[model samples]
Target: MQSLMRVVRSASALWPFYLAVVLFSSVVAGLGMAAPFIIREATDTIVDTVSYGTPAPTRTIVFLALALFAAEAASAVFSNVSGYLGDVMVARIRQILSTRYYAKLLALPQRYFDNQITGTIIARLDRSIANVTQFIQSFANSFLPMLLQVAAVLAVTTYYYWPLTILLLLLFPLYTWLTALTSRRWQKLERRKNAEIDAANGRFAEVIGQVKVTKSYVAEVRELDSFGTHYGETVALTRPQSRWWHSMDSVRGTAMTAIFLGIYLILFLRTLHGHLTIGEMVMLLQMVTMTRQPVHMMSWIVDSAQRAVAGSRDYFRVMDETVEPTANRELVAAIETTGAPELTVIQHSPLDAREPVIGFEHVTFEYSPGEPVLRDVTFRAREGEKIALVGESGGGKSTVVNLLLGLYPVEQGRLTVCGRDVADLGVEDLRASTGVVFQDSTLFSGTIRDNIAYGKPDATDEEIIEVAQRANAHDFILKFKDGYDTVIGERGVRLSGGQRQRIAVARAMLKDAPILVLDEATSALDTKAERAVQAGLDELMKNRTTIMIAHRLSTIADVDTIITLRDGRIDEVGSPAELASSGGIYSELLRLTASSSAADRARLKAFGFRVRDDEAKDS
Candidate 1:
């Protein structure tokens, strides 16, 4: 209830419209009560005229009919205006909620995203918010107006017969209690139904995202069978949901009928005893029949209310999540000191002259308690240096890069970027100093130019073209009829692996940040493609501190320094020649790659490492 009220209060900016709705609803309620009263008056006039053997009060009938028509006409105009204003109010509410929800998504920690799949997060955010909107609409169109109508009806009816009003007042609580009890069960079912629906959406999104793989393997029938099973579960749950809904409707209808009959019987008895006039009896009967409609509508109203409450709880759960640690005092101090735009590159020198451009000092970290992914790790990248981190999978190469990016806060020792403690620098400021390219690059659904210019949103056409040429993307981009304007489907699916990498490199190059990180950037491409994309990467790496992570040792052979990691610890650190002479972990890894390729074997021979076929073929 409080959540619903909070949503309502958020639209306080549109209070003028809300006030109009309330005023118009009151008028409609007044007009609704007038019709029954007018009928009672007409009936009384006719009864009196007949009893006295006098002429009918035709003038009085005509006047009452005119007043009823006038009331209805006025009510119609006000109701129309109220409905229009209600729509405007709800639209504004949706806009406010959507903006806040999206901002919250941006502020949330990356760990939150890592724990949830893209489809699941999208499903929950979209569905939960939609539920809130539906509730708001339902409340405006049905719930509030019905309450007003009920109050008006009761006030007029009670004025005519105080004793019967007392009886109704006694029964109203019973009706409310029954509806609340039934609605409690429905609320549980509603939550279950929403969960099933979100799960189905998540699965559908995941499968469709990999449709090419599914088709390649000829798993169409198998996928359909899996989806059909999920559909069956949804329908099964819906059946029980529908059953409960009907049960509530049944109870409401039967109870309403019984109450109406009891009210009528008492009214009929009182009329016989002359305690109630014939006209009063007729008015009470009409009002009792009118009460049935709102009473029937009550079941639906309660159900909507329950579903809204459940959804609001879920929506606010995400909204209430603690944001990333970038909200700390050190970040605030960094922001205040620079006074630079969030995305603007800072050119200031290091706080400490001895500190490297990027450094990790005894950094120990873990995603969960007591299961460290990195331990006693220390490394440095001097300005304009090209460093390579070569390691087996899960050897913490990416974690080190992630720490430098400030995606997660350091729980152990200190990490510095651009000679500033990452914990003390604003996240956007940290990001502003670096550009990155990953193995699986992400491109939004937009034109080629849009993807390339994403980092530098205000880049001129000439600048975009220059960077694209530097990254080797301009020539291929022009092959499409629309050139840079050509729409790249979601995640640049229209482009090949090499083409996507080039575009990603172009984007990073355009940013022109002083630090660059390339994480397995060419690992996904074929040899021909890798050679083509690597040229672009080389251009982007020039005059910047480059941090490269790759399983392919050949890719980093020319790097200034090579750091080999084993079991989350730095096992060896040296130049390619130095590590090769030492015959350490880096040397062994190079030999492993050389054993599989003639070209790599030739390169290894120059480094004085031999790959014996007997050793490679050993059981």
Candidate 2:
């Protein structure tokens, strides 16, 4: 309601439509009362007088009939004006919410997004906010119209007969009390139902997102059956929900029926006493019946309100979430100062960085509060280093990369990029220095050129092609019918794994950041593409400090340094040759790679390559 009112106040200039509503509502009420008067008068002049041997005036009755029609037409015109205003206000609200939602989305830090469900984040615009449009329309048009109609009926009915009007008025408090109690109960259930719906939406989206993996593992039916069970459970809760709603409706209907009969009984008694005309009694009955309609419409009102309230609660849940505060300092200054002692005077977090480049300084991090993922991670890749980070899965290697990029906060130490402390840097400032390519590279539906140039939105065809060539993505891109202009499906489903990886690399290359972190950049690539991309990555790494994460040992053999991470701690650190000779974790990893290479060669022997184990290792 506060949000709806805010929208109304923002569009206060449209209050004229509200005024028109009031004017027309009054016309409706006036006409509504006048029609009964015409009926009573016509009966008196014709039927009753005929029974008593008197005459009727046809002309006056016709004029009053026309007057009633005109009043109704006038009411419709005003209703339409109100509707137009409601639509206009709702349209404004849609624009306003969309702008605010997107702004908040872009402004929030990576941690918030990381913890949130992807489908939830994607669905925020529709789920809780969908009812906002209806709320604006109903609150303005229906709310006032209903209220005014009730008031008009009370006043008009009282003028004709105060006793009955007072009796009718007395029931309103009782009715409202029951509605309030019932609404309180149903709204709680509605809130729970909506929350569960969001949870289900998130879970369902997660399952579908990995449908390919599920298919490979043959878990498709099991996943779908689980979704079905969740749906059934969600439906089970609605039974109690419906019971409360029907209970309210039953109470309201029973009370109204008893009240209606009682009102008529009084009228019949009064008529028998010669205190009221038959026509007058009939008119009063019609008024009572008309009053029941809005009362009957109570269910609609409560249901709409309940849904709207639920939506508001959900939207506010996200909107009310707090983000990490950026400290008041220049982030780059703190980072540069650590390496160049003379430069350390100020401090800044990621939100306030001077460059997109990132640095890690004895930074340790953990997803859980006490279980550290990376321990005292200290590495510096000068601007443009072709760095590789290779370790077993969950070896804290990715954690180091994430911390260096400021995706996760350094729990025990500091991370600086472009010489500024990431903790104090502004988010945009931190982002300006780097582009990340993940093992599961993501691409959206767009032309190949657009996806490649996503990192640098203004990149020209020449620059995009150059980056693509460097990433070894140009040939595959040309395979599409439109080549650079061909649109890819969602997440680049039209492309193979190698193609996607290359494009992701090209994106990072085109971003042309001064620092690079390769977190399994070539995990899914063929050897041909891997070698080509390796060359590109080496060129990108030149003059830059890099931290790389590679799973395939052959990929990182020539890297500057290979640090073996065991659990959350470093187990070995040296060049691949040095570590291999030490007979440590790196040595084991290199031996495993050699074995795999031999197996690949034997598998390819049918092609008549006749490749030996040593020859394969050299290749």
| Per-residue C-alpha lDDT of model 1 across residues 53-134, encoded as one tens digit per residue | 8887789989988988887788788777777777776777777666566666777777888877677778877776677788
Candidate 1 colliding pairs? none
- Estimate candidate 1's RMSD in Å: 5.5
Give the deviation of candidate 2 from the true structure as CA RMSD.
7.8
Q: What is the C-alpha lDDT of each candidate?
A: 0.77, 0.67
List TM-score per model, in order: 0.89, 0.82
Q: Residue 471 deviation, candidate 1, in Å?
A: 0.7
Candidate 1 lDDT at 429 equals 75
